[model samples]
Target: MNEELRHQAYAQLEADADRIVRLIKVQMDNLTMPQCPVYEEVLDTQMYGLSKEVNFAVRLGLVDAEDGRELLEKLEVEVSKVHDLYMQEEKLESKEI
Candidate 1:
């Protein structure tokens, strides 16, 4: 792929990652429990879509497999952090009740 196309692919990947992170944050912030079924469904679908995008980039030679894996790992870490925060808040709320 040409440099421009490679750049575009990277940009799209970054956007996808940001979108997922934002949705997670919004759900966590607005919901009492972060484990809502609808939220889980949406998250799963978004994650699958992002994985497919990364796979396509790898297949097209726009990104390396290792790099794609790293990108996903970073997103996972962010999601985990948000989840932990949500759990902590839930614990605090329960204690207050």
Candidate 2:
């Protein structure tokens, strides 16, 4: 792939990651427990979409397979942090009630 296409693919990948992270944060903010089934469904769908994009980028020579995996890994780490925050909020709310 040309440099421009490669740059575009990388930008898309980063944008997708940011979008999902923002979605997760919004869901957490709006939901009481952050354990809604619908939220999980949406998250799963978003994650799958991101994976497909990464695969396409790899096939197009826009990004290496290992780098794509690393990008996904970073997203997972962000998700884990959000989950931990949700759990902490739940615990604090429970203590008040």
- All candidates' lDDT scores? 0.87, 0.89
Q: Candidate 1 regions off by >4 Å?
A: none
Clashes of each: 0, 0
Candidate with maximal TM-score: 2
| Model 2, TM vs. native | 0.90
- lDDT tens digits, residue span 10-30, model 1: 888988999999998898787
Using all chains and alpha carbons, the TM-scores for the candidates as numbered come to 0.86, 0.90
Tell me how candidate 2 scores on lDDT: 0.89
The digit string of per-residue lDDT tens for model 2 on 36-82 reads 78888888899999999999999979998998999999998998899
- How many residue pairs clash in model 2? 0
Give residue 28's lDDT in candidate 1 (0 to 100): 77
Ten-residue segment with the worst summed lDDT in candidate 2?
Answer: 31-40
